[model samples]
Target chain A: MNNVYLYNDSFNELISLIFYLLKNNIKPTNIKDVSYNPNLFEECIFLGIKSKEQDINNIALQFGYYAFRCIYYVYLSNNESKELIIYYFILNAIKYRKKITYMRNLKCVHETLRIAEYVSHETHKMKGFTRFKEINNNILYAEIEPVNNILELVSKHFEKRLKNEYWIIKDVQRRLFSVYDKKNFYIIPEENLKLEDFRISKEEKEIKEMWQLFYKTIGIKERKNDRCRMNFMPKRYWKYLIEMEDEL
Target chain B: MELKEKLKILADSAKYDASCSSSGSNRTSKNGLGNTAIAGICHSFASDGRCISLLKILMTNCCIFDCKYCLNRKSNNIKRAIFTPEEICEITINFYRRNYIEGLFLSSGIIKSPDYTMELMIKTITLLRNKYHFGGYIHAKAIPGASEILLRKLGSLVDRLSANIELPTENGLKLLAPNKDSNKVDKIMSYVKEKQNRKFVPAGQSTQMIIGATKESDLDIMSKSSSMYDNYKLKRVFYSAYIPINKDNLLPTLEKPPLVRENRLYQADWLLRYYNFKVNDLLNENNPNFNILVDPKTDWALRNIELFPKEINKCSYYDLLKIPGIGVKSAQRILKARRNFTITFDELKKLGVVLKRAKYFITCNGKYFMSSSYFKKEFIEANIVLEDKSIENTKIEQLGLFNE
Candidate 1:
């Protein structure tokens, strides 16, 4: 009989499921996200892992801090099998120590690195591409639609740069917003925000127009290479770029 | 003039300069308006394909001297605009807050005097850093003949500073930019280098060199770059392909930018910094110019065939980096992965080594990827991937690879 583990999209739930399966000595046929509702009644074990640093460090210890970060980041990716990959990677790392990360040829390690890279790339791009417009001359508001759930990753970056300002970064695709006040930042996950909340200022519109003109003037006529530009700043990202709006 | 009109004019005036780097500074403050990353951030790409990393512009396009190659020269007849210190500071803070720029690249013409231009720039940065509480990366150009005191004060405020070399040779300097002295530019660069405190100009100093304009050979440029790196410890030496903007007897009559030569110089520059290569390794007295067909590293590997077919698994980290397709990341991966197990050709590809180019130079456990004799240069040259052939027109590709 195959033992199936079900989890919510919480890091704690995934950790608890791993421990539960190990303790029961049950071979998991599949460990699936409960949000997806992959299974109805296949010997599912619903787990509630109260996340402790010691428990996480127990699983993440062998490969050091970097390996733990990769596990955290990759777990947040849109990859369906990300949870399974993390489990196998951690299991291997527990036996092998930090050398498991260098073993890229292994399927689990390869997928783990790929997912981490994918998420980090999106986070880095959002750091630059996320354009904020002053709404009502009081608060700054911006929107993005990243492939990965990277709002949590990019929030700390903005928190450092715009510490004194009140701002909101809306992940439009996921319908989540990372809201930061003058003091600190927190996330409001779900369809709680509305367009009416932000009223664009006339000065913000003027500055954006002026910026677009500067972008237009900054390029050289003789060295016009659209293919080269598209490679670095891909077409998917064009929707987020303010300068790209007028060109379309 | 309106803000839109001034932005257009000033940005147009500044586009000729190729340095848009905002890298090599790790700045943070408790409640500052901005912080800088170690690798820097590129805000956007202009239609011309250059990175819009910083709000690259001149404080004023109006100048006292007429440098023949310059668009903003005194005699160019272009519409000139001078931005006030207040305007510069306001825009820097606003744009930075909007995520439009990582910082600002402030270069100016010698309006009235060197000290005068430098002082205004220093004032702009001072207000932005202290008053606005902005902590973004600031790269400023040091006015060549500015007072040392002004340069020191300017250095303390910005993350990086530069003094453009303008031309490679002394004669080229005299012929085109007569008002400027190359030695004086060096004086400012040396001054930037001499800063004992790491906090001041923490990203270090860099300079720009205009190539293919005058009668200077490739050897002249490389030799000059070699010495500049040794003497001044420049963070970077930018090679701008001489774009023909004016009809001058002194300037070369080229319809297009010499991007190929510029690209080669950059590749050679990489070898100097990362790959443990000297300018002499890239070019000697007789072989002054580089091979137009292949990249500089590949070209060197083809000529020095005896060093070929190194065992990738057994080779040192430095030797692995010497291979064209094996970059720093791939080399490090190979080192780490090999410690666990013997790396295979398929595994090398998985590790991000470009096997197409690397196959000629590397081996795996006494097995070569392809059967190609190293005795013949043309055989190796023809067999190796012509990476540059596909990317001849787009200097923008270089921008993506080498941000700084």
Candidate 2:
């Protein structure tokens, strides 16, 4: 069968393009995996579906940028329909463009910014509500798989709050980790491994113990407003928060 | 005694204050140390179900003044504990490291004098920020009658600051908290507002006024709150419905707090800030308090029925926001969706607008749907759910109790 490349009038067919190139026994090595050969002796007769893999990769990467911009636009507008429209727009933008700079036009950029604002706002809200707990291994582990790409935004919050310690914020849905040592933060991609298998420091245990003690002491019995508590820190996030598990 | 025991006592005493927000101020890590998230963190919940992120504790439960409404009022017999500045700082830093708290909300009773209590509070904040490098959010209360220098010093270090307005009026303050002066509290608030103007307390100032204490009508309370907002540029005005914990001749003996009243006030406050509603719009001489049956917005809409059935296409964003249950989000959604197609009642529901309330005030295709006949008796009957017995009876009815 001919390569099954799904194409829309708008150029958002990068995944389909990858699928087609791989299906045709072609390994994408450079940006020319599906390029037309100009030096062919019979140009009119020959339909070259061959291009450098790098070219395909570059085009795919460019489309990724356009897609991200479109998603951001939908986010700022808080328009669910804009989400579908953005997908169509990016698909079209990619099919027609080779240069990354050409995709960074005003219209695409503006839409991306609007979505970014909304996504960023929600991410910020999650940062406040995301609670962490200490386990036996001494790792200050917080698990929040937020609806948006808020890993970086939330990681910064954990880094600042837990400044003088080591912690890991795991996005369980994405299977990504924003790990922070006393010094800096770095992202860890999921490698089909459990977090418990990872190494933890002894000092982390002492800090966790101290923290649990502090958390236990601060709550006042007379002032408990369960409805308000649930309003601010929803039960959906209880699994990751160490102290909330027993209470919940 | 152990630190845990002291913390329990202090937190219990502090819980009644009821302002536990951590938002405002965006602090990030610079010295490879702590950072502040603009979205504040709530680490845990108390028995009453409030989020406990900050180590919300008073320095001491010992008070000289006899505030009749207060649990820790000097005459009330309760266990009192005072934490040294070092103890508070250590607990705050430790809790913060474990990701249990965003920072400290250190309040205190008048341990000796307002100045001395304020000084110790200031010292605790200074130690946390400078010694511990605690760049996390700090919400410190400005002690009424505390020296101006102390208030200014505390304001410079903390992220958000508040001075409890305590009561709606001077007469209420006199009757409920005899020693506390309304003008003195206003003076402190003004000081906080001035410091906020001078680049201190970057989150601006907020104040709490106790509701249902001394017979101040909802109109009196809301008007004071409105003026506080207008003059102070206050970040928030928190309304805590008074729960009479201590028996006092001065205060009313109520079984439970007027929670519905508090809820109505919050709704009214939202209208004030976002819906361009004035205090007078919600209340006047004829309607001194919010109607218990319906929300303030719906009540206002019902009273001013002439504004109903506004054209969705022609109505400005502000005008669309006037409809009950159409908040900022739904209004914006309506604006965007209408750009692509004309919005019908069905489409409006899909856009997340509350049709039950909006049905009375809005229309589609210039055709009125909600008539007085549909809502006249049913709406009044529907609102009887706010009554205590009706709710209890409904609960019993749900459990299949027909004979009784």
User: B1-404 in candidate 1: lDDT tens per residue?
Assistant: 98778778888898998998888998896667888988878889888777888999899999998999999888887898999888988888889889999999999888899999999999999988888888899999999888999989999999999989989988889899999998899898888778835688999888889988987878889888889999999989999999999888877899789988998999888888888888877888899898888889998888787887789889898898888777888889899999888888888777766787777777888787666445366777876545545555466676667555
Give the per-residue Cα lDDT of candidate 1 at A99: 79
Question: lDDT for every model?
Answer: 0.84, 0.69
- Model 2's alpha-carbon lDDT is 0.69
Q: Tell me the lDDT of model 2 at B70.
A: 88
Fnat per model, in the order shown = 0.76, 0.42
Model 1: chain A TM-score against the true structure: 0.91
The stretch of ten residues in a row with the least summed lDDT in candidate 2 chain A is A1-10
Error of 2 at B385 (Å): 7.6
> Candidate 1 lDDT, tens digit per residue, A9-123?
6887687777666666656777877755544556666666555566677765657888888988988898978878887887778667877789888888888988998899888
DockQ values, each candidate: 0.66, 0.24
